[model samples]
Each structure stands twice: as C-alpha cells, then as structure tokens.
Target: MIITFITAPILGRLLHPSDFGLIATSAPIIGFVTMIQNLGLTQAIIQRRTITKGQTNTLFWLSLLLSLTFATGLFVLAPSLARYFQEPRLIAVIWVGAALTVVSVIGEQPMALLTRNLRFRLLAVIDIIGIIVGAALGVAIAWYTRSYWALLVPLACTRFLNLIVAAFAARWFPGRPVWDEAARQMIGFGAGLSMFNILNFLARSADNLMIAKAHGSVALGFYDRAYRLMLLPLTQATWPLSRIMTPILSRLQGDPEEYRITYISSVSLLMLAVQPGLLCAVIYSDATVALLLGSKWAEAAPMFACLGFAGLHQTFTSTTGWLFISQGRMRDLSIVGLVSSTSTIASFAVGLPWGPLGVAVSYVISDYALRLPFIWYMTGRAGYVGVGDIYRTVGPHACGLLMSASALVLIKASLHAPSLIELGGILAVTYAINSAILIMFRSKRRLILQVLKVACRSVMLHRTSRKGRF
Candidate 1:
C-alpha cells in the first residue's frame, strides 16, 4: 500500500489525467471480464473446510479454461467495448488489457489456495510487487511514449509476472481435474460472490461512467484523478486490513464469534486511520491535487473531497461484507448488492443534475445510506457485532473529523492560496500535523508510541552501525 501511494502520485504526474481517464473508460470491460474469470471458485476454495490435491487440480483446470475463454472473448469484443466507451482507439488497449484477465484466471485459484491456508505474508508481497511493477511500467511508458497505451503496457506484464510468481511460490502443480459433485457445490457459493463482485464493480465504477457519459473524457479525467487521489490515503491504510482479514475470516468461517470480533476490531482500526483522512482531504483538497498531481490537476480537488467521504463508506462496507462470504451466505450479499445497485443507479441519475460534482455528492449520500444499514444488517447474525457497534466505530471518527475540519476551515478561511503548489504544500503539512495528533489521541496511542519508539531505536542503531561506532 505504501509503495502504491508513493508510486501512484508520481506516476499520475508523469502521465496525463486523461491517461487515467482513458483507462477508466475501459474499467467496466476489464472489470466484467475479470469477474467472469473468478466465477466464484476462489471464494469457494477459501470457504471450503478441506481440499486435497485432487480437488485443487480440478479447480485449477476449470479456472485456466475460464481464463483462456474470457481473454479470447474480451479480445474479440474489443471493438464493441470501444464503441461502448465511445473511444475508437480503446479497442487495441482493450484487447491487450484482456490478456490480463487470461493471466489472472490462470493464477487466481492458486493464490486462493494460499489464502485458504492463511499464508498472507507471501500474498502481501505478491500484491505489493505486482502493483509497484505495474505502476512503474505506467510511469516509464507514459514518460517515453506519452500515449494512453502506456497505462496497460505494464499491466499485461505485471499480470503475467504475478501469475508466474504466485504459481512458483505455491509449488502446487495442477494435474488433471477429476469431475466431482463437490466441485460443482463450490461453484454455487462462488456464483454468489461472483454476483456481488460483478454488480459491485458496476456500483463502484458508476461515478466514472456517469461522468464520462454526462460530461466528456476531459471532464471525466479530472473527476477520476480527484477521486483516486482523495481516496488514496484511506484506501491504502484500510485495504491491507481487508486483504488480511478476509481470508482470516474464511479460516474462522464456522466460528461466528471470531469472525464478528475480527470484523468489528478491523472496522475500529479503519476508523482510527481513516477518520482524519476524510477530514484533512476535505480541508486541503486543492493542496492535495497540486502536491500530488501538479498544478494542472487542481480541478480534481473538489471531486477529491467527494470521494474522500465516499471512501469511508466503501472501506467499511467492504470489510463488513466479508462476513457473508465467510459465513457462506452469498445469497444475502447478492441481495444486498442488488438493493445497493439501485442506490448506485440513483446516484448516477443525480449526477445528470450536478455534473461531475453532483454525481460525486449523490454517490457519497447513496453509498453511505446503503452501506450504513447494509453492514449492520449483514453482520447482525454474529453476536460480536451489531448495529450499535457500527455506530460506535463510526461516531467518534465523525466527531474527530468534524473537529479537524472546523479547525482547518478557521486556519485557512482568511487565506486563498493562489498557486496549486502552495495549496498542496499547505494540505500536506496540515494533514500531517492533524493526522499525527489524531492518531496520538486514538485508542491505540500507547501501541503507536511503542512502535514509534522501536522504529526510532532501530534507525539509531542502523545509523550508529553505519558510522562505525560513532
């Protein structure tokens, strides 16, 4: 996540916001194809209590076949995707990007095997390295070629690499698959996860598509960049918790108590990290854009504010939704997503009125409205969490964020920063200071202090060692 945040801004600057937007246009296509490849098998494996070599082989072969089929189909439909996106040139990029789906399908289930066993560190490394590689490829290619294709040039490479690395790391060569009723049973569960993912993608990407359709690519570019930059800090921080906890939840699948406790604790941790991020981003919107994306991207600032709050809903809801998967209750998730999709469509409909900004506001309101209730209702089955715990984890953060936003408003009320760079620097500093104070006063203050102390000592030790007993 750290590498992603650092690399992404630099990469965004090196590339054009339109580069991001162009890719955004293809998001639905890529997302749809990726969803097809998953077909619920990966989730099924994670939820499965026991799996032998024979079962794993069956899942692998089925997944590989799906990957090949989906990739070919995507490439074939590239022109249709280009037509849908209204970008003629996107056909080639779509075709190339489709290959990633092929690679991912081939690699995904093997990765799921690792998740099934709780081998997360390896998973983290794979995720971080793949992102870093892809982002670096984006930067380098965008710098040299200066075309939209640069966005995907690294993607295909990274997917291929991730597939190879994950397979080798797992050391589980897939043999011929045996047809088993058990395998088919897993698919029923996987189908539910697949439904949630497919619709969820539509829900999440609604903003970008709405912007592009209502406005234009250029306008979409600005909004997309703002959304990405604004949500970066919170997403980076909380994403790991989900990535780690989901499989951990899967391991504790039968045990509702553990699942609920883990979910609530993780949500609390998310609040601790994310609360201040929302406040600070709203306060320093322009500064963030200028510092991270250069002055050319100042238009993305307000939209960033919209996404900053929207991110809170996404982060928490995604975590809470894991219970459905862990508890093997995919149907409930599918229904929740169906209801939430209405909110998404409604948000886009509202976008028609406000343009990009309006769309963003509608998105936040609808997202929170659905997620607030959905998270509680889904997790209610497990005793460790309930509707009130959601309020508990969320309310303080709201208070703290409100206080920080108030302070920030007072601080910057008299000053209108003329330059993007200045605004960015101000935000960078204010957010830093505010974030530190916020965390320092959170429930984890003592633990943070201890970690900071340990880090300081380690840095000192390393420096002393380097200076030869200085």
Candidate 2:
C-alpha cells in the first residue's frame, strides 16, 4: 500500500492518462489469459487435504503446458487485439503481458506449497522484495522512457524474481507428468474453480473494456486509477487475511463450529480495521486523489468516491471466496460467480451510456442490491456460517461507518478547501472517532483488544527469535 501511494504520484506525473489507459485496456484480456494459465490448480493444491508427489508433478506439467499454449496464443493474437481496440500501441503491451503469463507459472506450485504450509512470513518477505525492486525499476523506466514499458517490464521482472525466490524457498520440484485418480479428481475440482475465476475476471474487467471502447483511453485511464484507488484498502486488508485464513479454514472444514467462529471474528476484525478509512476516503475523495495521484487526477475523484461506496462492502465481499475455496464448495462458488458476473456486466452496460462515473455509481447499486445479498445467501446456504451470521458480524461496523461518515461530513463542512495537511488531520480525526465508537461497544472493544494482544505477542516473539538467531 505504501508502495502504491508513493509510485502512483510519480507515475502520474511522468506518464500521460493515455499511457495508463492503453495498459488498462489490455489488462482485462491479460488478466483473463493469466487466469487460464493457472487453471485453478493452485487453489486445489492449497485446499486438498492430502496430495501425492505424482499428483503434484502431473499438475505442474499440465500447468506448464497450458501456460505455454496460452502465452503463444496471446502472442499470436496481439495484433488482432490492438486492431480491436484501434490502438496499435497495444500490440506490444499485449505481447509483454503474454510473456508475463509464462513467467508467472514457473513458480506457481512452489508458491502454492508455501501458501498451503502457511509460510506467509517468508512469502511476505519475498513479496516486499519483489514489489520494492519492481516499483523502483518502474519509476526509473517511466522517468527515462515515459512509456508503458515501465508498467509491463517491471511486472514481468517482479514475477520472475518472485518465482525464483519461491522455488528456492520451497525446495520442491516436479519430476515428470503422471496421470491417476488423484490427479483427475484435483483437475475436476480445479475445473470448477477455473470457471468461477473466468466469470469473476470478466465481471471485474468489463468496466475497463467498455470505458476504453466507449470513451477512449484517456477516460479509461481515469476510471482505472479510481478503481485501483478504491481497491487499495481491500488489497491491503482483505487480501492478506484471505491468504492466511484460506488454508487455516480449509483445515477447520471438518470442525464447523471453529470455522464459523474463526471466520466471523476475523471478518469482524477486518471490517473494524478498514471501514472507517474507507468512509474517510469517500468523504474526502478529492483530497485523496490529489494527495496520492496529484491534483491532475482530480477528474477521478467522483469516480473514486462512487466506487468507495462499493468498496466498503467489497472488502467483506471479497472474503466470501475464502469460504468457498476453503470449504471445497467450488460448484456453489461457480454458481455465485455466474450470477455475480451476469449482474455486474449488466450494470456496466446500464451505466456505460453515462460514462465512467455512471458505471461507478451503477456498480455500487448492483453490488449492494444484487451481488452482495446473493453471495451472502449462497455462502451461508450450507455452511456453518449463515446469512444472519454475516449480518450480525457486519451490522455494528456498518453503523459505525455511517457515524464516521457523518462526523467527517461535519468536519469537512467546518473546514474550507483543506490542504493536504488538513486532509491528514481529518483522517486522524476520523480514525479517532471510529475508535471511540467501537470502544463504546463491548463486544467489538474486546475483539479489538484481543487483536492488539495477539499482534504485540507476535512482535515480541519475532524480536526474541531474532535475538536467539543472532
């Protein structure tokens, strides 16, 4: 998140909106191809209770073959995609994305092995290194070339580096392809997940495609940045939790009571951590855009604010996947994806006539009105956790969100066109208000304290371990 905030401003200054748009235009297709490259086997690797060496080797070889095939296909289709988008520059970008697809799969099984074993600390270190190096290189390239290669090259480099580090860390390698019942079953499971992923990607990326086609690259760039900004909190809060919890929850699948308690509490804690900040961003979207991406990006503020409403719920909504994947309910997950993708696409179409802001507004409406409820219903339908459980967990935080928004509104009204410093102060005040409100609730206060205690203990343990190592 810090890297994002730092690099966004630098990149925004060095590159044009069209530069971002061109890349964003290719993102949906690139992302979709990347999903095909995975074929969901990684999730299967993580979710399966037991796996044989033969099965892992088979999956690895299959993944490699698929990655190569798709990469070649993408490389071949680059010019066609550029023609479709009517932007010849996109051809090279798509080719780079195709190469990234191949590099990404080289360490897939190793990374999945790390995830399954709950080696998140090492994973975090690897990610930090990859991101820092990638960000620095991207900035340097952007400064020198002012081209979209900065974006594409750094991403490819990061994936390459991460895979190399992951392979070394895991110390596991595939032998040769083997076909057996275990491999077949895992493939079946992965098929469902892959379907869900395809639909989900389509839903997520449709907006970018439509905006780019309808309004052109410049408009798409603004919308893309706003969408990314809205996702910042979710990426920081929900992503790590999902990664940590998925394997843990998968282990707890047999113990429904524990799974229910664990998932609900973690989600509650996540909402408590992220909700207030999202509210502040919604209230001060302009300031956030100015601070993070420069004043030149002021055009994206309304879009960002509109998307922030959806993001408030999106943080929790994204975690629903953990429930699906961990519980091995891939079919139900696919059904949910089908519904979500259909509605999300419809929403995009409904709003495209009004441009990007309209799309943002429509997405929020569809999310709250259709997608969120459906996903909650489906996830709770047969699980230890139910819809009522979700409502109860998020209810108080939702109330707190309203209160925080109200407080920020009052604060904003009293201030006149506050500067960046004032915006920082407002954020502080918002968090303080949220903390006070949360403390007023006994249950939430207890959870907060419990989390703090665990955090402190982990820190102390880390320090002690470091001293012993030295």
Candidate 3:
C-alpha cells in the first residue's frame, strides 16, 4: 500500500491519462481471462484438508494446460479486442497480459501450498518484493517509453519474479498427471468457485467496460484511477486478512460458535481499520486528488468521492468470499455472484448515458440500495453468522463513519480552500473522532485492548529473544 501511494503520484505525472486509459480498457478482458486460467484450483488446494502428491501433480498439469490455452487464445484475440475497444494500442497490451497470465499460473500451486500451510509471512515477502520492483520498473519505463507498455511490462516482470521466488521457496515439483478421485473432487470444488469468480469479475469489471465503451479512454482513465484508489482498503487490508483467515476459518468450520465469533471480530476490526480513512477520502476528495495524483486529475475528485463512499460497503462485502470459500459453500457464493453481477451491470447501463461521473454516482446508490442488502442477507443466511450478526458487527462502525464524515464536512465547510496541511489536519481529526467513537463501544474497546496487548507482547518477546541470542 505504501509503495502504491508513493508510485501513483509519480506515474500520474510521468504518464498521460490516455496511457492509463489504454491499460484500463484491456484490464477487464485480461482480468476475466486470468480468472479462468486458474480455474479456482488454488482456492481448492487451500480449502481442502488433505491432498496427495498425485492430486497436486494432476492439478498442476491441468492448470498449466488451461493457462497455455487461455494465453494463446488471448494472444490470438488481441486484434479483435483492440478492434472492439477501438484502440490499436491495446493489441500489445493484450499480448503482454497473455504472457503475464501464463507466468502467473506457473507457480500457482507453489503459492497455494504456502497459503495452505499458512506461510503468509513468506507470501507477503514475495509479494512486497514483486510489487516494489514492479513499481520501480514501471516508473523507469514511464520515464523512457512514456506509453502503456510501462504499465504492462512491469506487471509481467513482477509475475515472473513472483513465480520464480515462490517456486524456490515452496520446494515442490509436479510429476506425471493422474486423474485420481481426490483430484476429481478438487476439480469439482474448483468448478463451482470458478463460476462464482467469473460472475464476480463481470460484476466488478462491467463499469470499466461500459465507461470505456461509452465515455472513452480519458474518461475511463479518471474513473479507473479513482476506483483503484477507492479499492486500496480492500486490496491492502481486507485481502491480506482474507488470505490468512480462509485457512484458519476452514480449520474452525466444525465449531459454529467459534467461527461466528471469529468472523464477526474480523469484520469489526476491518471496519475499524478502513472506514475512517474512507470517510476522510469522501470529505476531502479534491485535496486527496491533488496530493496523490496531482491537480491535473481534478476531474476525478467527484468520482473519487462517490466511489470512496461506495468503498465503505465494499470493504465488508469483499469479506463474504472468506466465509463462502472457508465453508465450502461455493454454490451459495455463485448464486450471490449471479445476483450481484446482474444488478451491478444493470446499474452501469442505467448510468452510462450520463457519463462516468453519473456511473460513479449510480454505483454508490446501487451499492447502498441494492447490492449491500442482498450480499449481507445471502452471506449470513445459512452460516454460523446471520443477518443480524452481520449488522451488529458493522453497525457501530458505520455509525462512527457517518458521525466522522459529518464532523469532517462541517469542519471543511468552516475552512476556506484548505491547503494540504489542512487536509492532513482534517484527517487527524477524523481519526481522533473515530477512535473516540470506537472506544465508546464496550466490545470494540475490548478488542482494541486485546490487540494492543498482543502486539506489545510480541514486541517484548522479540526483544527478549534478540537479547538471549546476543
């Protein structure tokens, strides 16, 4: 996340909006194909309690074959995709995306092995290295080439490096493919997850596709950047948590009460971590755009603010996948995905005629009016956690966000054309208000204290261990 913050502004300055727009146009198509490339076998590997050598080998070969097929298909379809988007630049981008797709799957099983074993620290190290190097390369490419290749090439490099590193770390290799019973079961499990993933991608990417088609690349660029910014909380915070929790929750699946308690606490903690920052984004959108992406991106501020509001709900909604995958409830997840994709695509259509800003605004409205309620209902309907549990967990934090947003709005209103310093101060005030509100709730206070205690104890233990070693 820090790396992202540091690089985005530099890239914003170095690259044109159309460069980003070109990449954005190809991203949905690449992302959708990438989803199919995995066939959800990684999640299946993570979710399953037991796996044999033969099963792993079988899945590995199957994954390789699927990836090659899709990569070739994407390479072949590049011109068609470019024609569809009416952007000739996209052909090269799609070809690069194809290579990236192949590179990414080369070590899927290794990465999934690490994940299944709960080696998150190792995974984090690999990912951080990949992202940092990628960002650096991207900046250099942007400085030189000053084109969309900067964005595309770095990602492929990162994936290639990640695979190499992960393969070395995992110390596992695939043998001859075998279609054993266990492999078949894993495939069956993955099939359901793949369906859900495809649908979910459509729901998420429909807006980008529609925006690019109707409003053009420059408009799509602004919307895409704002959308990516809005998604930072999910990408940085919730995603990592989901990775860690999926295995833990899968282990705890037999204990209903424990699963419910664990999930609720996780959700509460996530809301506490992200909601205040999102609120700050909403209240200070223009300043944030100036600070992060420069004044040239002033056009994205309203869109950013609108999407920032939507992100609050999305933070929690993103976690629904954790519950579904952990519980082996992919069918239920698929149903929810289908519903969400339909509504979200329809919402995009309704907003398209009005341009990207209208699409952004409509997204916020639809998330609150349609998507959020349905997601919460479906996710909680049959799990150890229910609808009421979901509400109670997020409700207080939502209230706190609302209050903080109100206070920040009033505070901003009182200040006339606040500088970057004032924006910083406003963010500080927002955090203070949220912290105070959070402490007012007994459960939240307890959770906070418990977390602090754990953190302190870990620090002390580390120091003591270092002293002993010395």
**Clash totals, every prediction:** 3, 0, 0
Per-residue lDDT tens digits of candidate 2, residues 185-220? 899989999999999999999999999989999999
lDDT of each: 0.73, 0.88, 0.87
TM-score of 2: 0.96
Give the winner by lDDT: 1 or 3. Answer: 3
lDDT tens digits, residue span 41-160, model 3: 999999999987778888888888998999899989999988988998888888888888888888788999999999999999888888888888888988988877788766776788
RMSD of each: 3.9, 1.7, 1.3
- lDDT leaderboard ranking: 2, 3, 1
Among the numbered candidates, top lDDT falls to 2
lDDT score for residue 104 of model 2: 87
Backbone clash pairs for candidate 1 read: 40-190, 287-423, 287-424
Off by over 4 Å in 2: 456-470
List the candidates' TM-scores in order. 0.86, 0.96, 0.97
Q: State residue 440's C-alpha deviation in candidate 1, in Å.
A: 12
